[model samples]
Target: MHRIFEFDDIIYAVLQHVKSSGTDLVNVAMTCSRLADSALNILWAEQSSLAPLIMCLPQDTWEVTENELGHIVHFSRDPTPIEWERLRKNASRVRRLVGPHGFTDVLKLPRGESFIPDLDVSGYVLQRLFAWSRPATLFPNLCELHFDAVFSLLECSSKYWLLRKFISLGLQALRFDVIDIPTHEAEQLLATLPAEAHGLRQLTVSADDGTMALTVPPSLGKLPKLIGLAIFGIDVCLTRQTIANIQQAWCLQSLKLKLCGTSCDAGGIPLELPSLKTLHLSDGSLPQCTHFLRQVTTPKLSHIDIRYRGSASPAEMTAFIESLSTSCQTGGYLERVHVIDESKIPDPLLIIPLSSEIFRPLFKFNRLSSVKFVGVGNFNLDDGFLYDVPDAWPSIRELKLTSWKRRAIDSVTFTAMMSLASRCRSLQTLHLTVDATQSTIIPRAPDGTEKLWPTQTALRNLHLGYSQVSEVARIPYFLAEVFPTLFDFKWYDYYCGHYDDPDIAMISALSALNDALQELWALRKSAGDHDLDERWEKDSDDSWT
Candidate 1:
């Protein structure tokens, strides 16, 4: 006789493989008592809407009528109370809850209007469901809760009560989408966070409507376990006292501010955030950023990303960069710096001066790895800046110099590239526009002996802008000598699109050189005593280029 798997085990295995819905799981549960226990757990793990579960109540407790639009469930006239014990058994298994739909627009239906008639009925059923489940804590196992279209529900006292009951469950993360809610009401909703929410690790509050402005409750700083906080499309002014509260908390590690306001008074208190590691500022005005940077000090910040609309004045830009540099030097080394300019300029060649003083403090920190200067125009660094680049940031893995003028590429450009290949061995991605013609002449020794290009074993991606066919022809040998690990090469030309197509002659030459290098490597591996020079001299006449 063959052994048989248990019924519950079979059901669990089937559930894992299939995208079984709640109704399908209910049917399986009715088939066997053992399956019922396991099926119910999987049925309520993730709930997009509570209608299906609510409809499971007895007909006398709640009646659902099917109409032309969809099924609408409402409280029955008969005084048949909800079976709280039975509902709690399944509700307790829910680990995540997505807020119901159509709470804001009455005409909008729930889940495509298939079952819910209007917002009024949806809100009525949801409120009663919460009221019944409140006795036993509806979602005892809930860890993540997302609230969408919460503005309309917050207007009703009973619905607000239901909202509070759910938030007091000590959830790990909470997200609120407050669109079109009055500022005061939004504040009230935020103030309802229970003291048990100290375990909350992530909190996000965003408003979709531009006219809506929600304030950040000072009580938020009291969440001891909170590590990530994101507030967008809301006006949150960080005053001296508020900064003090944030500093005292000392648990936050990541903060994202978008479309927010910051005010730094003349004698404002210094905002010291010692534990913050990542800060992102977007859509913030230049003056606002300057004030915030001047007041705030982050000792452990590792990443700073900024995106703004208009251009910053020279004085404002200088102050902001200096403040950021000072903070990085004191706190920890910066790993990445990204500045995106959103202003539109008519000229293609706009030079943004990145003076030595702006980058001097950065040289002291070795952890600086990825640097991107993106704008409509190019960025101009001082002369000989590239000479110290390898020494200043030896750990750099990504370097991008965009929209540079033709003058940016001169005789010194080749020397700079050689230096980067020799010194910054960790570089993996390099993006720059080079005049390949300037690199045709190979470097030679004082005695007129040709020197070999330094090998950059880590380089894998290279993007070179417009180059002549002749200029590109001379690069395959140099690339084979310098970048042994390079696999992705991109070059643009006025006539030949990209040099990546197989139909292109340049690509064929590159491939041949790559094969030759591979063959040479294989030969060295097979025979340790093989003279590489003799093999190369013999094949020099038949070289790929």
Candidate 2:
């Protein structure tokens, strides 16, 4: 006997199968009335643009013309006669409105002038669209709205008011690119935001031009529900009162300041953000960053990414990390740290050097899972650095130490590699430049006997730079013996050539390594060791159990 599935159950099953195919879901909706309601609901939930909905209007209400560029131009004298009932049915289902082009087609239609002139029609079209959208009935369920290009709106107050109306919809996330608002207009925009958008959780505002610095209104600090704020190409001056207002946003978790200039009053107090968890700063001056760090206290901060343009001194960078360590010592632990140098100097060695001493303070945070040190210049790591890494950061899973200068690396021997594998058993991804030019074989026991290497069951990805393939020819076999679960191995000359070049010695070593690994896997399979397959199949938590 066949059991009948409920309408909701059928829709759920069909949706699961067609989750990745929008076309299939639409077809299902068109197949029958019962499935149409549910399938259409899913199809119209996140609209990339309002063009499809606009096209649903009766053809009599709009006119289409062809331009010289062979592009279809839409001209509608009036959108008021549109079937409101049918439009509302689909519009209400929309949860996300992403306008990477800022609703150009819908907003740029020609009106009033039946004899279209050869001029810019965007202004006239936007004026009409603004009048139509001011009622707020177009998108009742929109929780997220993104505008990729908003330069047209900044020119007129009517368009700006329309923007305010959308903001008053109480959206969860609002992202817009290239907003160049005057100080007074910015104040007006900020005033309506807190009262109208109290539920806003994420806000991103960026300047239209990099050279033109947009001023951030202090009233933006009143956003009570804001948890993530990213501002780019803007100048934000923090006064004592402004800092206090920002500190009141207790729910803020992530803050990213890129190509942004932030300053405080001469006698203003420092900003304190105790609840922040992730912080990223890029393309700012050393003094600006130093002053900002000195003022802010982020006890809950766990992830930090800082990119340098060679303006920050090594001493300043060290001091900033030390300050974060001190502030988070009570109950907070840093999990990821990234330091990158963006200066693309002709001579890589001329770039600023970040010594191992600068990273010593990071050892205090024992919970670190990933640490990346990227330099266009040279990064100096002492011989004993790897020996202490396993103990200092036992939970480390991803480690990358990349530099252009190979001469900067020193004292990397085969024994050190064995020690790292043995100690950091949870390591899965590792990229390091090892000075293995002088070594030709794996390290032997003190009495010249064969040295036994510990098996690394968790390691899967390994990359070594600036190492001669002839010198470390046995590396693949050693890795296969130690890392039974290993899959990817990359060895390259950091300063010069590719590892995939036609070298007979390298090819032979790689072939022998593959044979050894396959033999080892065969032995494990015959011995009824299914644990290896299970470990590789299942996704285990980073506890390394």
Candidate 3:
């Protein structure tokens, strides 16, 4: 035997690597006594389903049947003391029961946007098992669980209360899905979890997209130990109280709250969250964004994502931008910001009056590295405003300016873009719509014979969204001159909401432009001149010369 394998840590890590593959792990375990001892614990530590664990009991005690609902298991009678002893030994090694496999691995769930597990037998089975598991849970050492079975806790029903037994003090992470659980019971169970699962650091309770909207449980503001909270398909009941509680949860750092309507109050005392770093809000109306942001402040806020379902009016847009400056502190430490409008606001693209005035407030955030706006109205921004962007955000890494409608006229000139690469030397990605119908190339050398591109930076990816480009033959050279380091370039397609495709001819032209960009980069790499932006042009000698 190798002397290095004698160390316990080395043996454990080697076994851990092959744990994901059952066949390899089994082979390693059979090879020696030391390997087998460590493999047993890893095998029982995480389970994708309880089917295998339930089979640990005596065969005569339980039965499995296949009906329309795929698979169901039932116990003929309670397990004897000997049977319980054997199960308890195996359960001690169980640390995680909520494996990657969903209920689809156990049952034939309905087809929908999501699968909400309907555990008619799981609840009953857990009750009988715990009746014998006194002074501790069945899986006493369990540290994580995804309790998918939703059960209604009726007034007279004592059976449903056993579901709470899974929330042990040692558990640190949990993903609880509520489908048919009564609103009052769900709220009570969530609020009381701190008593049983005081060590819990993460919790997520959500329903399917079209399922019943779960209410925000009371006393969320009191969870001092909870590190993250996310709730989806929520009705936002007690909106004022919920926000107030969240404001006081100083330990909370991340939040994802999707509201059903414009339920925020017009006026309230500003809520202060001293520890919050990331916020994702999905509002029903764009105005609600202003309403919500008007009252809360995240001092340590670094990343914010806002998604609204309706069209953004100029008034609402202006108010929303103003709230950003107030919501974050004077440090201007925000790093990533994304505002997306999921509205299918149709046609007349240029009718809405939008310009640099609405988004000017964001430029004050000196630490911003990434910014994205999609489905918002098109910007009639002139090159003068965009030219100031490089100086405003010297550390900027990514910028995606998108819209849902095709541009009638591109106001942003292509002439001013090279300055971004020159000034913001760290800039890497750029997504913008510009008028590339004319070239901005100037004399490169002391004599008037050669043309030079802009300053080279770390810029690698460029996506021209909804830009007007008539001079297709001139664009590749124009882009290569400015962004000599660029490797991936796309046209018209971007992520926000969606955009009406340009005419067929325009789509073909843009696609051809992308193909040409890739080919150019490949050619540059083949010639081993990827770093030198000084050498480039359309020379017919099949060489960079």
Candidate 4:
């Protein structure tokens, strides 16, 4: 090694070999002064990780070290109390410090245990490094500070005081996660946030309970630099005027609302968001939310993700989607729309329009590139959402359908899917999920008869439950057609017709899908006309116990 280092060419070759073998150069240098000095020179070129190490070093050593040498150390682990004391002494050099888990007392709170805490892991490091002068740790010069225990602050304790301290740090981004909060307490907390912290650019507040309602303080609307805001579990009976008041915020750009019920009273006046770009609403009755959206006139909006939870009629659901689509086109603001739900409500009212006629007459999502329908079961499309697809969605290239539960997919749903594919002229990829062992079959057109899809339509990707083939096989033979463009196929619990044990079949199907995806990817770059034969072989191989 020493001889090789005599020449640049040989040294480069050795370094390349070591790098390729994944050996750490630092460990090698630790063996000798020559290599250590060389490695130190290269490593010291980037001084970002130096502060924490200097803060943790022995007090005597820190006092003797030159200012330039402060960036040479790295902490072996999260700060110990001694290291924290050292940091407190040399607080000015402390710019960033990240701590190990449970650095603060916030973890004792119920919300922290059940949900999330606001303690910024890095703040621990900062605290230790600047322990000598805690005030110097303030974020006037700091750019990013993450505290995970903010959600636990509602409780009365030192943690609450810590939260207040964090807020005063002049952070640009804040994330508060928790499971639940009393409505009145949440309102008071929001109202208590010092108005001067208006410099906040991003805010994310989440709760896990779907049934609990959130009562956000109207003072939230007064934030000046608030660009992004996400609020979950906000199903209170908010007046339409209140929504308008919040929308009137000049700088808000991204908004996410998780509603538990259908009670939004956006006054009859149209709510307008001129600067908003992205919107996500989850857990609500589609009909009620649609009416609420009609009052929203956001011309600059570009993305929307809507998730329905309550039971509503299919017609109402379709009309809701249609109305939202029309609003997007008229404002020329929509680029993507995603609908997700976990409810398996079987009211023909909810399913019919979404699957069949509702999306037919409307212009295809011209500006939209992605669309997702998740957790759809007992879905019907005979009336509207399932009508023959429209051509307006020329820009749509990817589609995803995700459903849970075994009975979410049915024969009618699959047949309607074929109709949707026939209309997506520019569609490049599609994801279809069937929950159980059934698959729908679209029969071949009669001989000499013209049909929209005379043969099976091509899909780039397909995901089905193990029972998809068995269900589709029940149909006439002429209806069987492989996806011509299929490159990837996944099955969850895919089973052969003869599996004696249902549980085993599910496990087998899951295994087969994983294996198939891997094998296909391995062969993706291979040149071959053996696509059909290869797929069949792969599927057959997966069925083996």
Instruction: Highest lDDT: give the candidate number.
Output: 3
Candidate numbers, best TM-score first, in rank order: 3, 2, 1, 4
Clashes of 1: 1
Tens digits of per-residue lDDT for model 1, 249-293: 578898776655444445364577878888877776656655656
Displacement of the residue 318 alpha carbon in candidate 3, Å = 1.7
> Which portions of model 1 miss their true places by more than 4 Å?
1-90, 98-128, 149-162, 194-196, 212-215, 233-242, 261-269, 313-316, 342-357, 404-415, 440-449, 465-473, 491-545
lDDT of 3 by residue, 1-545 (tens): 78888888998888867776555655776898877767767777776556556667887887666556545556877788888787877678778767445322332233376533433344456566667784245678887776653222222254235557676788877776555566678778888876778887778777646556665554665565888888776554445656776665669888887766436444668788788888888855777766767778888889989988777778888999889889996547798889887765545444555788888888888888988887677777877778888878878898878765656578887666665655678888787877776665453676766656546658876777776665543666655656656665666543223367436746654665567566666666775875534443422122100
Question: Sorted on lDDT, highest at the top, how do the candidates line up?
Answer: 3, 2, 1, 4
Q: Would you give me the overall lDDT of model 1?
A: 0.60
The runs of at least 3 residues in candidate 4 whose Cα sits more than 4 Å from the true structure, single-residue gaps closed, are: 1-132, 135-141, 149-156, 168-170, 177-195, 207-222, 239-242, 260-266, 326-331, 344-355, 361-364, 382-390, 401-426, 432-459, 464-485, 491-545
For residue 8, give model 4's deviation from the true position in Å.
Answer: 24
TM-scores, all models, native as reference: 0.67, 0.77, 0.79, 0.59
- Residue lDDT tens for model 4, 307-396: 776555567767777667655545345777777664655443333324545545334445667777665444333413434333456566
Error of 2 at 326 (Å): 3.2
The residue pairs that clash in candidate 3, if any, are 221-245
* Model 1 / residue 4 / CA error / Å: 16
lDDT of 3: 0.68
Displacement of residue 51 (Cα, Å) in model 2 is: 1.3
